[model samples]
Target: AVFLTAFMPDCDGPRTRVIEEVPVSDWMDSVVDEEHAPPSVFLGPEFVRRKLYQLTSEEDYTLCQSLARVSSYYVADQQQRPPFSAARYGAVTKVYVIAKQDLAMVEEYQRQMIAGIPVAEVREMADADHMAMLSAPEELAGHLADIANNYT
Candidate 1:
């Protein structure tokens, strides 16, 4: 058996448009306080170049392609909605480890999303933001270990 932890992708969605549209600096200011503002207001060209390079790297391209395909499918599925359906994947169990901060954005799907799925667990990492792995690695690792022990 394998245990997996959920994480938010580095992309903005309709529900996060307000924070996404704001200058990155403004958003950071509110979240981290002006006194500790980030070095740059927005993602500089250098950062973008590095990210593009990383995304296109041989080791990551496969994941990039898979994400692109999934994104396209999600959009198309949304446009032709009947009732919500789960994505078809071979995993024996799927646990959606949602961050407390991201709950607002995904709340709408809470009722319809897990209708027939066997969600082995739905753990919330309290006091953690979207990037919990980076912000709270120890806590995240503990949770993952616990999940692994229980599942395996």
Candidate 2:
């Protein structure tokens, strides 16, 4: 099984639909400045700090900033594309690993997504935030390994 850690699956819904549903406050900066190239999504450092990660150290915040990118419209368009039927992907063993402490994609929404699309298994890490890869790497890795042992 391909264990998804703090991942929102495609089958849950379209980006447009999900965005509409989620209470995402002023998260995007559509403005194009000299420093920020045209047609880019800008998520400021403060937002990233408060909304994206459970930073245990200063380095985690720095990592968040360094990893930030101008989310491409093409990718957004692709995400906006119609969702695949559950039947199409039902054959594959999907596992959802929920990050309980995530502020960006909160536990309720994660549960809703999981409920939207039935998965083979669901694992959870109570300490992890949206950036579980950084916040709770060992636990995430352990879950992946466990899932792999069962599926692969």
Off-target runs (Cα >4 Å) in candidate 2 are: 1-16, 26-39, 73-76
lDDT score for candidate 2 against the true structure: 0.67
Candidate 1 lDDT over residue span 1-152, tens digit each = 22222312211233232233334442321222223322212323333223222223344444434443111113232334343233434245656565454322332233233433466677765544434555456777888888888887
Q: Encode model 2's per-residue lDDT on 1-152: one tens digit a residue.
A: 45444444555565455554654364533332333333355676766777676554578788667877766433355565776566765556788888888777778888887786668899999898777788888998898889989887
Q: Largest lDDT belongs to which candidate? A: 2
Candidate 1 residue 83 Cα shift, in angstroms, is 13
How high is each candidate's TM-score?
0.39, 0.76
C-alpha RMSD values across all candidates: 12.9, 3.9
Q: Would you give me the overall lDDT of model 1?
A: 0.40
**What does the lDDT read for residue 103 in candidate 2?**
75
Clashing pairs in 1: none
